[model samples]
Target: MKLLSLLVAVALGERTLRPRGRNWVLGVGEQGPAARPPARLPAPTLSAPAVSAFADPAGALLAGLRRLLRGDPTPRCEMSRFVPLPAPASWARSLSPEASCPRALDGEWLMVSVSGRDLSLSSLLRKPAELQPEPVLITMATAVLTVLTHTPAPRIRLGQDAVLDLSFAYAPPTPEPAASLAPGPPPFGLEWRRQHLGKGHLLLAATPGLHGQVPAAQEGAVAFATWDDEPWGPWTGNGTFWLPAVRPFQEGTYLATVHLPYLQGQVALQLTVHKPPDVSLTPAPLVWATPGEAPPELLCLVSHFYPPEGLEVEWELQGGPEDGFQKATGEKWLSALHHHSDGSVSLSAHFRAAPVTTKHHGARYACRVRHQSLPTSGRRASVTVEVAGLSGPSLEDGVGLFLSAFLLLGLIRVLSGLVTDCDPQEKVTASTPPTF
Candidate 1:
């Protein structure tokens, strides 16, 4: 194996190693009625599975032909050519993983010509009923490719370290005597850009082996670091880049462009940093509003979350005194909001008003907050309804009543005693004043 690898590498003139489709549709192709495979004993068969992975039915149909054909098969059909065609300009960043990007894609046509026996079209079946396969799957072809899914691409995630792999399907362009990015000629470059990020001193010379260094910092043959794109940094014609420690500022559209010695195109991915809400829940245990006058309210506070999308607040009712919570409906009040001086915003959802019946003795109304950050059940807080039944007044009310009665009785007694003492003694008061 090592000898074989070495020989292959030497044949390709590689100092060391080399290496590495969705919207995925498949179509089957059949030859015209006039076309037919010549019965010259047997011929080499093409492997249909090798050309496309999704052509499973074509693979099964070709397998039967391979078994019947005894001896070395002569090659009949060959894969002409396939190229990675870029999406139309109007599609823009259509391939971006962001949900906002339109998923509708313009179709690309694939022309297939098969040389094999053609069966007469079934006249009984209508045009709509006739079979129409996708992506040109060939069943009776003599030569075909044993198709398999290609090497997996990079898994992009925000705030996580991952390899930004830019591998070529074909053997890369011939290695020059010049320096490479790594042991082999793998591309090593990292660039981040957005207007809000402001400017940094990041620079990359057009020459190879620059590796994210400022143009001024590099040595001989810097070539003055000329490029049209202003935000470029640390990139050359390498096959891969080690993207490390993704930060919040890096959240935005990330476009990976390739300008090889002979080719140029771009692909993009989206990165959005999600700030999970602080989710402070304040459950008011008492009735949320004045009894018999206003609607009862169950309030939920969702605070400090990023990308302030709309959230859902649900109120659940306890089925019975001892029963678990179930879905309860109420007229939704407007959401309450809280804002911080630092510019953080939070919203509160209130479940108030709307009554079906007032028999809510010890019934619990739970307020559940559903946001992009929370789980399926969401962040919840519950409050039990203390139905205003035959209970006495509160302690403060009872004490106030006692104090008012005592003060009133004392004032009445003092006024009556003064009035009773002054009336009959008025006649004796005049003679006593003259003697004095």
Candidate 2:
């Protein structure tokens, strides 16, 4: 009795077991579709299972059972292609069951022709119907770039250290019809190109941030610097590059290109280099001296500028017009300017002018600075020589001294006359004559 129960349990377990599209048996053994041998003589032929029948599990099981009871029919799978839209009329008309389809392109039409002996369209339609292709599936790919800087215009001072940052990021390609399906990471690279400035116009240094890689910088010419990123599958991340410094060049607009893998993408970067002049005005003696003394010198200092070849300095009496302003000439305005090794300039101007009076007081002697780097208004520095007050005796003190001097002279003369006349008037009869 126990053995009988064990056999029944085994049977139940076998019946419950189900495998994916594989052959099975009930209380017996079964052969897979691939392992069956062909029949040599005439025999009863069974109908094959329809591909569409798989959509209904119960119906597929019933059909599979019926086919197994009789002689099994050969199963076959077939694929068909439809010509994409915009194709020639002949091409569309020529589509056949054996024709192969090319890979579908984005924004292009594609036809999927599905048919097989096992999958009966007529049965599903409940009547004979024409075959048609389904909608096309398009795949989209993109690459995005962003630039960040420490300065407003990403400006770099000539011969001075500066750094610019660039960030490159991208996402994986998305397959249409099934947007959730993302492609595995594709290989990517980076190349830098210059548009405006010629090579060697300025020295440039490139360094990649963490997660950034450059595989071919030296292989390419000076105009292009190449980089490659380590593969990170279908994930969104970014890399950065830094431009530490640049040598002096003509002040103008410059364009840098980033050769990206994006289709129909515009990826060019821009920067500006300016050499605005820094000016200062000074007088040898900041204040005016007495009229008898020699005139003081006016000095102007121009510093921290670039491309000094065409630099010019003009002197103005206050804020005067350019025509009214005098350009620094010969010895009157001596320039001790020299171009520095670092592509910068430093210079001084000297001018001699008379002492400041009330007319010239508070009037600004301006040094207008001009250069190719400066804007239309230009840059300027000014100095004004002020009048100095006299430090001497006042009118009240002079009058007191004169009066004392005159009084001393008169007393001395009177004393001298009295001493000389004393002996001649020595007669004693003066007192008796007075009494009579």
TM-score of each: 0.41, 0.40
Give the C-alpha miss distance for residue 8 in model 1, angstroms. Answer: 19
lDDT of all the models against the reference? 0.36, 0.38
Name the lDDT of candidate 1.
0.36
Candidate 2 lands at a TM-score of: 0.40
Question: Candidate 2 lDDT, tens digit per residue, 248-342?
Answer: 64333333322222211112234455467788877633445444343367778888787666777777664212233454332355566677776
Tell me each candidate's RMSD, in Å, in order. Answer: 17.8, 27.8
Return the top candidate by TM-score.
Answer: 1
Error of 1 at 279 (Å): 3.7
lDDT of 2: 0.38
